[model samples]
Target chain A: MTGRDGGAPLEPLGNTPVVILVRPQMAENIGTTARAMANGGLFHLRLVSPRDGWPQDRAWRTASGADRILEAATVHESVDDAIADLHHVYATCPRPRHIVKTVMTARGGAAELRAATERGLKVGLMFGPERAGLDNEDMARADALIRYPLNPTFMSLNLAQAVMIMAYEWWMAADATPPRTLMTNETHVATKGELENFVSHLVRELDGCGFLRNEQKRPGMVRNLRHFFTRGEVTEQELRTLHGVVRELAHPRRAED
Target chain B: MTGRDGGAPLEPLGNTPVVILVRPQMAENIGTTARAMANGGLFHLRLVSPRDGWPQDRAWRTASGADRILEAATVHESVDDAIADLHHVYATCPRPRHIVKTVMTARGGAAELRAATERGLKVGLMFGPERAGLDNEDMARADALIRYPLNPTFMSLNLAQAVMIMAYEWWMAADATPPRTLMTNETHVATKGELENFVSHLVRELDGCGFLRNEQKRPGMVRNLRHFFTRGEVTEQELRTLHGVVRELAHPRRAED
Candidate 1:
C-alpha cells in the first residue's frame, strides 16, 4: 500500500561523508553517536583523545549493534590531527565564543556541509568532551560553527542527541528521496475519497443495525469519526480490507460478504 | 518561560489513568510498552497474564527509568474482570473485527479517552496476547477500537512504540498550552517589525562582507537565510546576542584579522 496520492518511490542521497568525535568523554555516548551516524548512512567514525581509548568495552556495549562503526573507527590524539586530511570542518556550539566567523544554525550548517560534500570535499564535524564542551581554541580551528536554537532554560543536549539532530538534518537535505514513505504519495491502500465512501457505507450499515440510537447525535459522532480517519490518510488496500470486514459484519451469514 | 505568543501556562495533566496488559508475551516488549506509556505521562501500569509474573526482573531492567510503572503495576484475570467499573474501555487492533461500535486512530482514541477522563470517566485501554492481538470476543466487550496507521509492508510495531505515539499526541493536545516561552502580555520576541529589521541588517552585513558578490544571487540567498531565522521567531534576547556577534564580525580587531 502507498500514499493517499499516487505512490512514488522514495529517493534519498547515498553519498555524504561525516567526521565525528573529538575528545569524547563516555564510551556509551560514542556507541550511541555511532548509531545516530549510521541512521543517516554516515559511516566514517573519527575519535580524538577518547577517555577510555580505542575498542573500549563500554563503547561497544552502548553502541547497540552498530558494531561496524566501532570496527571501522579511526583514532587520533588531537582535533587538528583528526581532520588533517579533510578539506573542510565545522564545529558545533550553542553560543558565540571568541571565534570571529559566520556562524550557521544546524539547518544552515547542514546545507553548507552538503554543498561542500557534493563537490567531493572531505567534511568533518568536531565535537568536544561532554563535561565542558569544545573550548574557544577548538572553535577557532573550524571554518564554521554549527548552532541550534534550543530552549534557553535547558539547552544542554546529550552528545548523542546533538549528533542525531545534525545527522537528521543533513540526511533530510542531501537525500532528495525519503528513506521512508512520507504520507503524501497516491499509491496508498485507500485515498481520502475511498475512505469517505467506505465510511458512508459503514455508517449506513450501523444505522441498519440500530446501533446509532440518537438521531441528532449521529451526525456529530459521524463527523468526529470522519475527522479522525481523515487525519490518518488511510490507504487503498487498508480501505478495501476494512470494506471487506464491514461487509462481513453487515451480512453475518453471507459467503465473502 | 511560556509560549512565544504569550499564552497560558502549559503543564501536564496529573493522575492520568493506567493501561493494563493481560497475559502479554516478551519481556523486552513489555519494557518498551512501559516506555511508550511514560512518554505521554500515562504512568499507571497493570499486568495480567504476563509470560513472566509480576515484578519480572527482565521487564524492570528493560523499562529503563520506567521502573515506577513496573512498581505500581496491578494484576487482573479476565478482560471484563479488569475493566468492570471503568466507564470507558478501548481495545487496540490493526483492523476491524466483529466487535467494536466505534473505530478510532490512536490519536483519536487518546483524545476521546482524555475527554472522557476529564468528565470523570474511568478509562481503560486493553491489549490481548502478542502473537494474536485482541480476539473478537475480547474486543466485543470494549466501548471502542483504537487503530494505528502503519506501513502495510511492516505494520507490526513493537508494542511500546505504538503506545508512545498515542501517548505523546494525547499529552500534547490535552495540555492545551503551547510549549514556547512568551515575551510579554501582547507581544513576543521577534515581532514582525523586529524580524524585518534583522533581515535588513543581515543583508547589509552580507553585502559588506562581499558574500553577496553576485547581484542576481543576492535576493535568493538573503530570502533563504531570512526564511530560516524567521521560522524560529528569534527572541528579543537572541536578537540582541546576534547583533553583538554581527557587530564584532563586521568590525574585527587587527590582531584577530
Candidate 2:
C-alpha cells in the first residue's frame, strides 16, 4: 500500500538477509516463510534439498502476493553450497546439540547480522525442517546458534515464525532509529557542558556545606553527582530548573524578614 | 514428541492465551492461524464473528495435526463477547490508526502477556482481517496496540504469520533462559557482598586522595562506583584482582623502597 501522505518512498530499506531452509517438508510452510520474509523486508531464499521438491503450486498459492520471493528462491543440494558466499551464518536450533557453541538470542543475532550487512558481507540464517532441527554437522558449519528462551514444556515454534522473528529483529536493528520519535517541539536536548556545569556547581556547594566529608572519595562522588543529571536526556528547561534549585538550596539564610 | 531427557513431562507450559480472530474472512488464514497457535502452545482460540462460518473444513485441513485446537475452538457473535472475560487485550495493528494508544513490539507485548499469565489474568490477542486492519472503533476496546516495525515498502504480513510471531514471542518471554547456557565453569560470579565491599574500599581510597571533595555527593558516587563493578557478572578471580589493584593503588610509598 502507498503511504497515506503519498510522498513515502517506494523502496524497502537495507540489504536482504538470505534465508536457508534445510530439508523443509511442506510446500505451504515454504510459501508462508517466503511471505513472512517479504513482510519483514527479507527476499533472498535458499532451499536445501526440500522434501516436497521445489516449484510446488501449493507454495505459490499460499504465498499470497509474495511471488517475487518464491521466484527468486534458489534450491541447493547441500547446506555448504547454499551458504558458500555468505560471511556469517546463523543456525536456529530448538534443542541443544550437546556441543560447545556460541549461543545468541534472536535480538542479539539480528544485531550481529545487521553489522555484517553494514560491512558489505553476505549473511544467511538457516532453519531445519519441521520435525528435526539442525543436525550437529549442519550446526558445526554455522557461526552461532540462535536460541529463543522458549517455555520448557512447549518449545516447538513454527518454521515461519522462527524466520519472522529473526527478520523483524534484523530490520529493527538495521534502521536509523525506532519509527516513532518523541515530539520534542523543536527543542534540542541539553548539551553535555550544560549538564556538567550544573552538576559541578551542585557538588561544589554541597562540599562547602561539609556534605562530602570523605576526602578520599571525591572523584567517584563527583562522577555520581554527574550521572544523576546525565542519566536521561536533559531538556533545556529542566536543566535551568535544576540550576535554580541548586542555587536556592545552597543559599545562606539571611533571617526571614 | 518426547524430550531429550527421556522422562520430560508431557504438559504444555504457561497459560493458553486466547487467539481471537476479529472479523477474519479467509478460511485458509484461520486454519493457518490455528496451526501457528498450536505450534507455539496456544490452544484457546475464540473467533469473533468470522465472515466464514465456524467449523471450517479448510481451517482443520490447514491446521495439519492440530485437530485438538480446532475441536476446542469457540465462536462468539461479537468482539465484546469474545473477549468479555479477558483481562488484557492486545490488538495487532499494521498501520498507525492516528489515535492515542500504547504501542509495543511483539517482544515487549509478549513479556507483558507472560506477566499477565503469571497473575492468572485472562489474556487475549486480537487480529483483524487481511485487507483493512482494526478500525478506530475496534482499537478503542484494546488495551494496547501490538506494532511490528516492518519495511515501509512491503509492510503486509500473512494473518497466520502475524499470529505466529506474537505466539512465538509469548513463548520465548515466558521461559527461564535462552535454550543454550554459556559454559562459565568453576569460578563463581562475585557475590553482592564481595562487590559492595570492593566498592566501599575503592571509595575510601579515592576519598583519602582528595578525589571525592563533595560530601553530599558521596552517596551517589558510591552507588555509581558499585554500579560500574556490578553492571556485568564479574568472576571471583576478577573480583580478587580488582581488590588487589585497589589496595595497591591506595598503599603509601615506603621511603626505603
Best by the lDDT measure: 2
- Cα shift from native, residue B181, model 2 (Å): 4.2
lDDT of 2 by residue, B1-257 (tens): 11222234333345767998888888888888876776566878888778889888888777655567778788898888998898999888877644545677777788888889889998999998777777777788988788876776566576887887787777667555553334335566668888777777888889998889899998898778777877656666667888888777778356336
TM-scores of all candidate predictions against the true structure: 0.47, 0.61
Q: Compute the lDDT of residue B15 as modeled in candidate 1.
A: 44
- lDDT scores for all predictions? 0.65, 0.75
**Top-TM-score structure, candidate number:** 2
Q: Model 1: per-residue lDDT, tens digit, B67-117?
A: 666777777777777788788887776655333145666556777787888
Interface RMSD of each: 11.8, 6.2
Off by over 4 Å in 2: A1-13, A23-28, A50-59, A96-98, A129-133, A175-257, B1-16, B26-28, B39-41, B64-68, B115-121, B178-257
Tens digits of per-residue lDDT for model 2 on A1-257? 11222234333355767999999999998987877787677889899999988899999886756678898889999999999999999898876644656778887788888888889998999999887878888998988888865444444457877887787877777655433332234354678888777787888888988888798998888878777766557666667888888787778355332
By DockQ, the best candidate is: 2
Model 2 residue A86 distance off true place after TM-score fit, in angstroms: 2.1
**Chain B TM-score, one value per candidate, order as shown:** 0.70, 0.65
